[model samples]
Target: MGIELLDRTALVLFSGGQDSTTTLAWALDRYDHVETVGFDYGQRHAVELEVRSVVADGIRRSFPDWGDRLGEDHMVDLQVLGRISETSLTKGMAIAMADDGLPNTFVPGRNLIFLTFAAAVAYRRGIRHIVTGVCETDYSGYPDCRDDTIKAMQLALNLGMDTRFVLHTPLMWIDKAETWALAKLLGGDELVDVVRTQTHTCYEGDREHIHDWGHGCGACPACELRATGYRGYLARQQA
Candidate 1:
């Protein structure tokens, strides 16, 4: 059976990246009311933070139906995460594989902390659903992105907060290619264009160079995945 649309409100963890933007579209399509939250954790690719407003505006202007459903946005200051994390995303270091076979770009406990804060905000706002874009497929080996971890977090949030907040990971099982397709499916070419032109996913925070997929350094792992996924998406379309 097809999933039933929830008439409740949702708060999406939107970072203005392709995946997050896509997930925002997904939430806007499903929920009656939708809000957004972003974190300023002093990452190297802070450009993603700047583009959040632009992408949100694009969605508001292009897709009026979703625009009507879209609601307020929130920003959280988690610079402490940056201070505490020694990974490449939080620090000025090379993106390399660590000894434990994970990318240095993996900021430890990022999704966990994000969910905790999001749940707090949701608890106050009386929102029942919290949406995020963390995916294991086509991801950079982040343990927190795993399905099991998200399920555990969901259980822990309900127990700790005493609220039955349904954590939504719409992109958890999908890869980058399918993600592009999902954008197209959710909002058509206009939404796809918003994702391709407005979102920022480069780890190096280089928005000066624009590619067909979007703005990025095109060499970072994030860019590589996005670009490869776009290519695969196109190939499937042509196939």
Candidate 2:
């Protein structure tokens, strides 16, 4: 089967998590020229940065065909963004509801900024497509994860930079289980195994307490959502 993509080159906003890793595979499958970019925004789960390094290396080693086509993987430092935001992901504060009913983990304009920086990077590299793993379903209530926000950001980017950059959200409408299905479809079972065992999604970044969903503390909302989705996907496969 041929990979369904309108563009031949892409840049994925990879974070070395389940969804972002899956998105990377999706890009690798379709785009002839693909690269990944990650952010270091002073998050509490700094281990994910290490995980990103390992996962990027693993992709190059395991999937040589895809890796050969892959471009330079970038890790941009945005600690100033974290310093200005009071989110739990960055500041390690309590997970309380904000005045707008969003979680304390909602870092305002983080995704927007990430996508904008990604657009600049892509424009410089002559890439027009930017793939992100943001989703609304089974998400952590980050407003920036919404499709509308992405569209707005895309338009803002194109207008601001005078470049026709297409923001691709492959997992925008899919839940966690469907995201796993996508990984299997794009990279096959080995890719599924890699994502299940290698990626980091825990808020605490506890690699010791491995679960069906991946490595997580099992107490945070991210772990709960991931584990539940993995169980659902497994059941679906069995049935």
TM-score of each: 0.96, 0.94
lDDT string for model 1 (1-239, tens) is: 11232438999999999999999999998999999999999999888998999999999999999999999999999999999999999888999999999999989999999999998888878888999999988888899999999999999988887768899999999999999999999888898899999999999999899999998899999899999999999998899
Stretch of 10 with least lDDT, candidate 1: 1-10
Q: Please list the C-alpha lDDT of all candidates, in the order they appear.
A: 0.92, 0.86
lDDT of 1 at 50: 89
Native-to-model Cα distance after best TM-score fit, residue 28 in candidate 2, in Å: 0.5
Per-residue CA lDDT of model 2 for 106-153, tens digit only, reads: 889999899988987887777878999999988978989998999999
For every candidate in turn, the CA RMSD to the true structure comes to 3.6, 4.0
Highest lDDT, which number? Answer: 1
| Superposition TM-score, candidate 1 onto the true structure | 0.96
